[model samples]
Target: MAIDLEIWWLRCLSFIIVIPFLGPHLVAIWKMLKDLLFFMVIIAIVMIGYGVASRSMVYYPTVNNFTTEAGGSIDNSFDGRSVFRQIIYPVYYFLYGDFSDELANLDSNPDAGWSIADHVLLAVHMLFVNILLFNLLIAMFTKRYEKVHQETRTIWHSQQYLFTREYFTRSPFLPPISLIYDIYCLIRMFVFFIRRNYFETPVYQHTRVFKIIPKKRDTIKEWHNFEDAYTYEYAHDEVKALKTASMKSKSGSDSDNKDDTTTDDNDLNNTTNGLKQVQRSLTRLERIVEELNVQLEGAIEKKQNPTTP
Candidate 1:
C-alpha cells in the first residue's frame, strides 16, 4: 500500500514537467517572485530595526530596576531565545494590523518618555511599511506584469521551442527501455573506438541511430520551405482576385451619372494607389524569393560536386 501511494505521488509530481506548456503567465509570476525576494530583504531590515528598538524600550525600565540592586541575576527574558518571540514576531505581526496586543499595555509602563517614543516609532514604522513599501512593491509587480503581457506570444514560442528541444535531445524510450538504449549506445561507442573511426565521424552525423533516418535539420527546413511557398501562392491569388474586383467596381461606377463621376474618380485614384503599393510589396517579395532560390541552387550544386580536400 505504501509503495502504491508513493507511485501515485510520483505520478502527480510528474505533471510539473509540463508546467511550461500550461501558459506564458508563469513567466510573470517568476518575475514577481524575484521582485518579492528583494522586497523581503528591505522588509527584514526595517522589521529588525523596529523590533530591537521597541523591545529595548519596553525592557529598559525592568533592566534598570534590576541593575540598581546587587547580587541578583537578571531574568531569562533578556536572553537570545526571547529576542524572536518578544521583538521580531510582534513587529512582523504589527505590519498586518495586529497592533491591539502591543498597544494594550503601552500606557501601563512607568516611564512616560519611553512609552511615548515607542508609540511614535510604531506609527512611523506603520506608515513606511503599509503605505510606502507595499505600494512600491505593487507598482513594481504591475510594471513587470505589463512587460511580460506585451511579449506573451514570443515568450510562449520560446518556451515551447526549449521544451521540444529538451525532449528531442533525449532518448525516445522511458526508464527501463531507455537503459537498454543507453547500453546499445555504449556498445556502439566502444565499436567506433576500437575501429579508430570515432574522430572521423562528424558530430552531427554521430547521432544517426538508424541508417535510413533523415536529419532533423533537413526535415525542418523542408517543412518551412513548403509553408513559405504555400503562403506566397495564397497571397498572390488573393491579391489577383482583389485587383480584379476593384477593376470591375471602378468600371461599373464609371457607367453611372456624371455628377458622381468626380467622387468615383477620387475613389479610383485611391484604389489605384493602394494597388500600386501592394504590387510594389509583391515585387520586393519576388526578388527576395529569387535570391533565396539562387542561393539554394548553388548550395545543391556544391553538395552534388564536392571539391576534394
Candidate 2:
C-alpha cells in the first residue's frame, strides 16, 4: 500500500512540475486550437462531400470488374467494405501524396469504366485539400504565432503573477496534510460567514483599504523614477549637443587662423567659456530636478501614510 501511494504521489508531482513550464504558453495553444477547430469544420465538410462523390464513381466500376474477372488489376485501396476505409481514409491519405497507385490503376485500365469525371474529381480534391486548405491552415498558424510572440513578455509576467499568488496562498503541506489545511479553511470560512451575518461588529470585518494604499505608493515611486531618468537623459543629450557645437566652433576658428590669429584665439576662448557655462547650467538644473523629486516623494509618503502624531 505504501509503495502504491508513493507511485501515485510521484505521478501527481510529475504533473505539477509541468504547470510552471506550460503556464505562459497555455493561452497561445488555446488560441491555436480555436483556429484549428474552425479549420477542421471546413475540412470535414469538404472531405465528406468529396469522399461520398469519389466513392460513388468507383463503387459500380469496381463491383463489375470484380465479378467479371476482367484482365485489369483491381484497385482495392478505396474498395473496402466500410465507408471509412473506402472513402474517408483514401481521400485523407491522398492529401499526403498517395496518388500514384490510384493514377496507375486509371491508366492501366482505361476501359475499366473510369472516365474524365473521375480524373477531374481527383484533380479538384488535391487542388483544394493539398494546395488551398493546407496552406490556409499554415497561414493561420503563422498569424497566431506572430501575435503570441508580440505579447510573450506580457503573457509571461501575467503567468508568473498567477504562479506566485497560487504558491503563496496554497497550504504549505503536501497532499494528505494539505487536505487537513483545506478543512481548516472551510471551517474558518463558515465561522466568518456566521459572524458577518449575525453580529453587528464582526471581528473579521477588517477593510483591505490599507493593503491597496502601499501598492499605490509603489506605483507612484516607479513613475517618479521614470521621470527622473527621462530628465537625466534629456540633460545628457543637451550637454552632448553643446559640446559638439563647441568643438565645431573651435575647429572653424583654427581653420581661419590665416586672417587675424589673435581674433581666432579670442573666439576660441569665448566658445570655451560658453560651453563651460552651458555645462554648469545643466548640472544646476539636474540638481534642482533631483531635489524636487525627493520633496515630491516625501510629500507623497506623508499624504499616503501620514504619521499618527
Candidate 3:
C-alpha cells in the first residue's frame, strides 16, 4: 500500500521503453515454446552420438509393448525404452556427446519407483548440463528473435500514438500511489511482451499493430446534446405516447380521464424545478453526512485510545 511515486514513474518509463514494441515479446514466447520441443530433439541427437561413440548403441530398442516399428503392441518394457530414448537424446547433448545411453539401459524392468539418484550424481549432473544445453538453444533463438525485435522497435518508435495519447489515463483519476503500483506491475508484464515482439513475422506486425491506431472520441456534449436533433415535439411525443398507453391500460369507457390527466406546462415546469432542488440538496447532504461520519469515527477512536482511559 505504501507505494513509492519515484518507483512508479520509473516503472512507467520502463514500460514505455520495453512494451512500446510487443512484437519482440511475442516472438520470445513463441521461440521459447518452439525450443521446448527442440530441447528434447537436440538431447536425443546428442544421446545417439554418445551411444555410437561408446559402442553401446543397440537397435532403436523397443520396450513397454512397443515394436521396433510403430502400430505395434504396447510392450510395457518397450514403452520403457521409448522413455529411455527420450531421456538419452538430451543427456548426450549435456554430456558433450561423451556419456553413452547405457544408463538408459540400466534395467529391463523399471524400479518400482524409478529415479537415477542411487548411483549417479543425477541432479547435479542434470542441472549443469541442462543449463548449458538450454542456454545454447535460447541464445541461438534469441539472436534470430532480436532481428524481428529491431523492426518492431523501429515501427513503434516511429508511431506517434505512444506520446500523443495520455498513456496514464486508463483510470483517468486513480491516485498517484495506485498508478505507481499499476505501472510497476505493468512494467514487468511489458518487459515480457518486449521479449515477444522479437519473433513475430512482418505479416503479424502489419495486421495486429496497424489496427491499434487511436479512434477519435466523441465529447460528452456531442453525444448527450440531442436537443438540436430531437425537436420539442419529438420529446413531447414520448409523454403523449405514455399517456395513450395508460389510457389503453384503463377501461376503454374511462379513456376520457387520460386526456384530462395530461400534464400541463406549469406542472411540467414545477416538476423540473423540484427535481433540480432535490439534486442540489442531496449533493450537499451527502457531503455533510460524510464529514459527520468521519468526525464520529475519530471521536470513537480518541475515546478508545485516550492517554489515561
Q: lDDT for each of the candidates?
A: 0.74, 0.71, 0.51
- Residue lDDT tens for model 1, 44-82: 999999998887776664743434245553334566777
All candidates: TM-score: 0.53, 0.51, 0.24
Q: Model 3 — TM-score against the truth?
A: 0.24
Least accurate 10 contiguous residues by lDDT in model 3: 206-215
Candidate number that wins on TM-score, 1 or 3: 1
The reply for model 1, stretches above 4 Å from the true place, is 1-22, 61-81, 171-205, 208-309
Ranking by lDDT: 1, 2, 3
lDDT by residue for model 2 (1-309), tens: 999999998555423323545544666776899999999899888988988886666656545454325554344443346667666787777767976467765666566554456788888988998899999999998899789878877776666665566667788999999999999989988888788788844465453231222346578667667876886687678767766766676677765656656666666677678768766876787788778667867877788788896
What's the number of clashes in each of the models?
Answer: 0, 0, 34
Compute the lDDT for candidate 2.
Answer: 0.71
Candidate 1 least-lDDT 10 residues: 208-217
In the range 75-158, model 3's lDDT, one tens digit per residue, is: 234465665655455455545544454456444434512223322444455654568776887787777567656677664554
lDDT of 1 at 199: 58
Q: Cα lDDT for residue 251, model 1? A: 82
Candidate 1, after superposition: displacement of residue 72 in Å? 13
